[model samples]
Target: MSEVFERYERQYCELSANLSKKCTAAGALDGEQKKQKISEVKAGIDEAESLIRKMDLEARSLQPNVKAVLLVKLREYKSDLNNLKTEVKRLSSGGNYLSARDDLLESGMADTLTASADQRSRLMTTTETLNQSGNRIKESKRTMLETEELGVSILQDLHQQRQSLLHANNTLHGVDDNVGKSKKILTSISRRMNRNKWIIGSIIAVVIVAIILILYFKLK
Candidate 1:
């Protein structure tokens, strides 16, 4: 079970790192390149999710106690996976594509706008494309902000869990210490009782001997 969780964690980290690299490169990439990278990242994410589902199923088939930790870790991995997906979508819809499209439109308009009728038509088309791109950019920004907020919430939850675990561990340590002290006190009491029993028995034996000797002397 631990091995399966480790494997899942390794895959998750690899996918996340790869996605991070692609996101960094996305801004520098041309539209076609960015699109290709996005597709590849999406495929990687899908593969990771498939493996996670397999691991989750395996965990569920185990005994309840054994499955509990795995289930918790799996939940965390799922949250991270969601964050990664949001990041990839944001990177894939970056402003680079919009900027490139605008550049192409401007170049084309400059070349064709020598004729007044062509200029008017080109201007209308360019304006519509710009407006559409702007709307998309706005939507993407909104989505990215929402995703960021969710990621922050997940981090906070994880932090709280860590703190709770730490407190539980400390409590267990205190219990152990108390148990050890109790054992020592019991051992001391047992030793004292044994010594007192031996002493009392010795004193009784001596008194018996003294009485027997006195009776023998008096009778003789």
Candidate 2:
């Protein structure tokens, strides 16, 4: 990230130097060179803006005390980039180049200082807001982490309960199988007892009839 910032700074410095040279020249730049330079400057500005946005996100991820200082620096970098873009645009416009160049050379220092002071003032005024926003982001992330942990805990408990229920169901099935086997044994025993009772009664009646026939023959 610092590398990105440094690259942007170098490109801005080069653009500034080129603009200063053009200011000193009494004539217009070669058409092709001017167009290429403008294109390069524009690309540099876009890259710088992209880097600054990344820096802003990095700052927001930090602690509030650290984020506040970084936010201020990012704002300053943004302001400087805006100023450079304005100067590049002035340099690229052929019709107003002379007047713009003269004005830039004359008032650049005072204008930069003034812009710096104004940016500092604005940053100071918004420090509390920036800090508050950083704190909110920090809190939100913390809450999300806690919620994720809680969800994991709940899933673990549910899994444990499911395992317990499965064990209980298996035990119930084993008991039911044993009860079914006991009922089948009892039914077989009952059928055997009924068959034996009928055979014993028939044997007793046959013996009594034999005794009566023997007594009657002896009396005759």
Best by lDDT: 1
Can you tell me which runs of candidate 1 are displaced by over 4 Å?
1-114
- The TM-score between candidate 2 and the true structure equals 0.46
Q: Worst ten-residue run, lDDT, model 1?
A: 109-118
Residues 71-182, model 2: lDDT tens digits: 7777676776676666665566565434544656564643763564465455444544555666798899999999999999999999999999999999999999999998
For every candidate in turn, the CA RMSD to the true structure comes to 23.3, 11.2
* Candidate 1 lDDT by residue in tens digits, 130-186: 557767988999999999999999999999999999999999999999999999999
Q: What's the CA error at residue 87 for candidate 2, in Å?
A: 23
lDDT of candidate 1 vs native? 0.68
Clash count list over all predictions? 0, 0
Q: How far is 104's C-alpha from truth in model 2 (Å)?
A: 20
| Cα displacement (Å) at residue 151, model 2 | 1.5
My TM-score estimates for the predictions, one after another, are 0.46, 0.46
